[model samples]
Target: MNLYKPTDERIWTGREAGQNLYVYQKVEQIDLELQNIPVSGDKTFVLMGYECDEGVRRNKGRTGSKEGPQTARRQLAKLPHHLNENTAIFDAGNVVCVGDDMEKAQSVLAEKVTQILNYKGLPLLLGGGHDIAYGHYNGIKKFVDNDQKIGIVNLDAHFDLRSNEDGNNSGTPFYQIATENSNGSLDFPYLCLGIRNDANDKILFERAREWNVKYIESELFHKQNTSYVINKINEFCKEVDFVYLTIDLDGFSSAFAPGVSAASPMGFSVDIALVALDTIISTNKLISADVAELNPTYDRDDQTAKLVASLLHFIIHKVSLL
Candidate 1:
């Protein structure tokens, strides 16, 4: 159960040995059981916890007067403890505290994720920000064989493909991924879902179109049923051998998830979002997944964190069934 040990000397004194909250085994027992159940090709789930407070500090101007960054850390802290009992916590402990250094943060994340994939396990990442996706994709790219294709399914309000306007902030993950081609080609097929129209930048949209990324706008999901969205996702998944799923909390309606950098008023309802996620997991080719951008300070009584926890549970349960 003692999966996480605070590396920071300053916080090490406060660390309580056998404290279940700071440990992984006690929190994610259920998930581990699922891993034990096994799949044909050595399937495993490794949860990589990268707590990046650095991105927050760098983007303080965009954060405005909100305590978005601190809130993100607090909400993420609850995850290791909450999932400990479920047997789903991956590794001896996959939590890595990257104390605000962007380059080091990316390196640490990339190394851990590469290790996970090397072991043939799915990397379920819990993020510091959307910026983390850049490193996440990079790690996955390193391990994927030349014959295999990696696909990304991003569920977010924004496209996140911005072209480094403010030097690689939260809004430019996909741009980083798309621009970086390893071993002679774009590493994956990046699909974005639940995007809010107003949240997208014109340049980002144009870039997505040019790259042939498939996306479903929020308005389209509202107009159609879950089956329609699922069908679209399935179609997209058909083109790739492995898939990486990224869920940004901002994709949900403000009522359900207000703990995010940019809250979207007319976003997808919780029920619809779950339905979409359920459909995606059913594909059985999810290589790695992450849920990011949860800022607890803007949340209404922990509603957003609770909702995210429940969705995580659902995703784990569904994957276990496969």
Candidate 2:
């Protein structure tokens, strides 16, 4: 398992003798190798943990997200199953960062993600940090042709396009990606949702424009005008063949998602957030997805992890509907 550690604690326990649907033990935890998952069928949700946060530490953000994968697994396992017998789930375990070599960890994650997609399993990546997006994107690139159009839709507060001159930190994945595009390496049709103007600076905005990045401001996600946001997503959906969806917990208001690397004070609400996600998911063009920045250390009573699980639950449920 190169950089991967087998998923061991996906199990859930409760007090007293009781029948429970919220317990993770209710679901099966199989030790899945890349060869075991089905390549074509009803589709299974393959859970892979990207367990490294060196990027966040480099980005000067909170560093506890390295533990995000297992924390999220605890909550996700308890989510009530909404799909039928036709659909199943598998845990491929965590890609542990044995050292501070973040680049190596990301490359390893990209390889694992490629294996999962090759098997026709929908990779539901649990993150170490939002930097997970870089490797996550690379994995999707493996299954896609260079001539094919792939849209990257990031649900986050920051552009994450910060200059990588400082090296590959959590804030610089997209910038490194766009720079990679300078060589005409591959197509990166990117659209960032929930970007807060206050969180980014003039240089970042300038870089975004230079990269031709499409975005919707965080303020627009308010009550009066969320439909336009949906319209923006729908329009972005129309442009590409497949979309790589990344959800950053910080994209939501710190009130709802306080357990992230960098919490946003004016982030979107859970209600509208779900709406935008459903709009994209319903389109059925999702290639793969990841939920990043779930730092359980900062979370209030596990609310953020629960929210991440809810999104996962809803996403799997929606896929089953399709």
CA lDDT of each candidate?
A: 0.65, 0.83
lDDT of 2 by residue, 1-322 (tens): 3687778752454332355445363344544554466543576778888898899999999999998988888888766665656676777888877778888888888988888888788899998889999998888888888877778899888899888876889999888777776666423588998888888999988878876788988878765787798888889889999999999999999999999999877898888778877899888999899999999889999999989889988888888788
lDDT for 159 (candidate 2): 91
Off by over 4 Å in 2: 9-35, 183-187
Root-mean-square deviation of every model = 6.5, 2.4
Best by TM-score: 2
Model 2 poorest ten-residue lDDT run: 10-19
**Clashing pairs in model 2?**
none
lDDT of 1 by residue, 158-270 (tens): 88877775676677778777777634654448888887768877877887787888898888775357777888889988988988888887788888887776687788887
Task: List, in order, the clash count of every candidate structure.
Answer: 20, 0
| TM-score for all models, in order of appearance | 0.77, 0.93
Q: What is the lDDT of residue 260 in candidate 2?
A: 92
Off by over 4 Å in 1: 1-43, 56-88, 91-100, 182-188
Native-to-model Cα distance after best TM-score fit, residue 96 in candidate 1, in Å? 5.7
